[model samples]
Each structure stands twice: as C-alpha cells, then as structure tokens.
Target: MVKYLIRRILVSIPTLIAISIVIFTILALAPGDPMGEFALNSGITAEVRENIRRSLGLDQPTHIRYIKWVTAFISGDMGYSFTSRLEVSSLIFQRLPVTLWIVGFAYLLGALLAVPLGVISALKRNSAFDMVLTTLVFFGFSLPTFFTSLLLIIIFSVQLKWLPFIYNDTLQLTDFNSFIELIKQSIMPIFVLGLWQTAVLMRFVRSEILENIHKDYVRTAYAKGLPNYIVIIRHVLRNALIPVVTLLALDIPSIFTGALVTEKVFRIPGIGALLIDSINSRDTPVVMSITFIYGILIVIFNLIADILYGLLDPRVSSTK
Candidate 1:
C-alpha cells in the first residue's frame, strides 16, 4: 500500500506539471491585459503603464512569465494579486476556511441523511414513501442550484425573515449568540449545496443496495436464520458501499466547484467567488494559482478515492 501510494504521488508530479503548463498557456492566450484596468485611469500615462507592466514582469514573453510564475510557485510563493495587490496565498488562506466550513458541513450532512433515506427507500421499494422520496429526489436533482438558492432565500429570508439573505463574513463566533447567527446565515447555503448531492448519493445508495440484496451471500445469510437487519447490514451493506465510497470520494471536487455558484448566490466571500472575480478582472496570477490549486485538489482526491477503494474492499489490492 505504501509503495502504491508513493508511486501514485510520484506519477502525480508530472501530471500536475502538465496541468500547470496548460492552465498557464490558456490564461496567457486569454483576452484582456492585466494593464488594461490601469490604462483606463486618466492620471496614468502610457510610460507609467509600461513601467508598471515591466515591474510586474507582464512585459515579458508568455513563456518567460510562465516560467517565472512556476518557479515562484514552487518556492512557496503564489505571487501577488494583480488587482488587490495582496499576496495570492494570503487571500486564499483568508477565504478558504469559509468555503470549507460551508461545503464540508453540507457534504457530511448530505452523506448522513443519504444513507438512511437510501436504505429505507431500498427496503420499501415501490411503496408510497419510496415513490414520494424518489419524486422529491428528482425534483431536487432537476432544479438548478442558483434557482433553489433564490427560492430558499425568498421563502426563508424574504418572506419568513427567518434567515439572513446574505452571509456575513465579518461575523465572528466568539459567543453563543454569534454562533447562532452564523448558523442562521449558513443554513440556506448549506441546504442548497446539500440537497443536490444528497439526491445523487441516495440514488446510488439505493441502486447499489437493491442489487446487493439479491445476491447469494444475502440469501445465504437469511437462510442461516439471520435477522433481516443483520443480513442487510452485515452481508449486503458492506459490499454495497464499495461503489458508493468511490462515488463520494470522487465527488469532493464537485463540492468545491458547486460551492462557486452557491457562494455567489449567498454573497459569501469564498475561494469560488474570488476565482470568478479574478477571471473577470483578468488577474492572471490569482486565476492561475487558483486554477492550479483546483487541479491539485482533483488529483489528491482521486488518489484518496483509490486508497479508499482498497480499504473498503479487501478483495481489491492496493499494491496492485
């Protein structure tokens, strides 16, 4: 297992490098100069603009700039934001926690709800409860996150005045009252993100369990006078969760991406919103660094998924 993990890490180095090159090249070729905004200022002369570009190394060839950026990135420097003039790493550190708090809570909550809902649905099969849940699952799946977010805001925030419409970034949880306020602001965003993920996960869980329940091992366990719960839990659920493990592990990347939309809707200041803002402003360094971070996350999560696959199913060898 250690050898396999080492191999995967070693392999990921080249993959990440290639991904960095592609991301850099694409951003380089993208329309909009970093100096365009500066040029728009009436007080800034062309010579001054040129000097600013030179200082930032934006005057260099694309390859040269890419090389310099990559070198800086390797040495624990993420470069400064073109617009904010803040260190890219510092900006990310500030916002990353907010995104993690929202997305992480949603993910765990969705998983917790999904397992039981899926088990009940599978057990009941075509019963009325199962049918109703199935319909609601489809409804949640069909609705776009932004739409759902708005609807939630309207119903909960605007109409009922039960929750805050937008998240408060400055709200610190130093007291119980502050914590309660944070929860109130977070509820809609968490629900919006979790609903779709739960719908998807529940369907997978139901399908996998239903397929496993008919297998020979389940039947044999039942024939041996095991209770229905014991047969289902011991003989069926373990195998059924193998694929679900893969699904959940691989779905981490999507959580971050989806948080982009949810954050925008709720006006949360997070990495996703930062990325979008950077792209619009043509802040190449911020955009490039964030994109690279995303690529790294995807690779890391995929490795985790592979490791989890081995752990969940001993028949699947990790060293292989």
Candidate 2:
C-alpha cells in the first residue's frame, strides 16, 4: 500500500503539470487586457505603457509567463489581484473560512444522512417508504440547486419570514445571538447544497447495497445462521462502500470550490463568489489561482480514492 501510494504520488507530478499547462494556456488566450485602461488613456506615453506591460510580464511570451507563474506559485507568491491590488493568496485566504464553514459542513451533513437513508430504503425495497424515498431522490438531484435556492428563499424568507435570505458576512460570531443569526441565514443555502448531494449519494448507495445483498457471500452468511444485520453490515457494506468511496472522493473537493449559484443567491462571500467576480472583471490572476487550486484538489482526491480501494477491499490489489 505504501509503495502504491508513493508510485501514485510520483505519477501525480506530471499529471498536475499537464493540467497546469492546459489551464495556463486557456487563461492566457482568454480575452482581457489588464492594462487596457493605460492603452486607452491619451495622456499615457507609449513608452510608459510598454514599460508597465513589461513589468507585469504581459510583454513576455505565453510560455515564459507560465514558467514565471509556476515558479512564483512554488515560492508561495500567488501574485496580486488585478482589481483589488491585494495578493491573490491573501484574498483567497480571507474567503476560505466562509466557504469551509458553509459548504464543508453541508457536504458532511449530506454524506452522513445518505448512508442510513440508503440502507433503510434498500432494505425496505418496494415498500411505501422506499417508493417515496426513491421518488424524492429522483427529484432531489433532478432539480437544480439554484432553483431550490429560489424556492427555499420564497418559502422561508418571503412567505414564512422564518430565516434570513441574505447571509451576513460582517456579523462576527462573538456572541450567542450572532451565532443564532448565522445559523438562521445559513440554513437555506446549506439545505440546497446538502439536499442535492444527499440525493446523488443515497441513490448510488441504495443501488450498491441492493446489488451486494443478494450475492453468494451474503446468502452463505445467512445460511450459517448469521443475523440479517450482521450479514449486511459485515459482508455487504465493505464491497458496497468501495464505489461509494470513489463517488465521495469526487464530491469532497467541491467544498473548496464552493456552490457558485447558491453562494451568489445568498449573497455569501465565498470562493465561488470570488471566482464569479474575477471572471467578470477579467482578473486572470485570481481566476487562474482558483482553477489551479481545483486541479490540485482533483488530483489529490483521486489519489486518496485509489489508496482507499486497497483498504476497503483486500481483493483490490494496491500494487496493481
């Protein structure tokens, strides 16, 4: 397992480089000049403008600029935001806590709820509860999160007036009242993200459990006078969870990405909202930084999933 992990880590280096190259190429080609204002200013001399462009590395070739970017990133300097005039890393750090609090918690809540719900639904099969849950699961993921956000806002914020529609970023959690306010404001957005992810996870878990439950091993365990619960827990869950782990690995990094639409609707200051603003302002530094972070997360989580395959099922050879 350790050898396999080391090998995977070695493989990830080139994979990340390839991903960075693609991201850098796309961002470099994207329409937007950071120094467009200087070019448009009649009073600015052409020499001064060229000098500024040179300073910003805009005068360099795309490949040269990419090399510089990677070097700076490795040196722990994420460059400055074109609009904010602040370091890109600093800006992202400022917003990281907010995204983690909301989106991270939502993902955790969804994953936890999905396991039991899926198990019960599969166990019950075609019972009324199973049928209802299946129907709900179908609609849960079928409806977009943004739509759910709107519906939730209308019901809870407008009609019922039970919760705040807009998130309060400035409200420091210095007191119990402030904490309660945060919870009230966070409910809708969290629910929207959580519901969607829960539906997706539950459906997959239910299918996996149902398939594994009828296998020869499960029948043999039952024939040996093992309890139904023991057979399902010991025999069924281990194999069933392998694929679920893969699914979870794919979904977990999304907490860092944040829910773009839900955050926007709730007026939350998060990485997703920052990404949106950067794109609109044509702030390539921030945009590239966020996308690169996402690429890194994908590679990391995929590696984790592979490592877990060996742990979850001994049949899955790690060295292979």
List the candidates' TM-scores in order.
0.93, 0.96
What does the lDDT read for residue 83 in candidate 1?
Answer: 93
Top TM-score: which candidate number? 2
Candidate 2 TM-score, C-alpha based: 0.96
Candidate 2 local lDDT, 75-189, one digit each (tens): 9899998789899999999999999999999999999999999999999999999999999999999999889999999999999999999998999989999989999999888
In candidate 2, list every pair of residues with a backbone clash: none
Q: Which candidate gets the maximum lDDT versus the true structure?
A: 2
Error of 2 at 277 (Å): 0.6
Per-residue lDDT over 21-48 for candidate 1, one digit per residue giving the tens place of the 0 to 100 score: 9999999898878899987899999999
The parts of candidate 2 lying over 4 Å away from their true place are 37-47
Assess each prediction's global lDDT (C-alpha) against the native: 0.88, 0.91
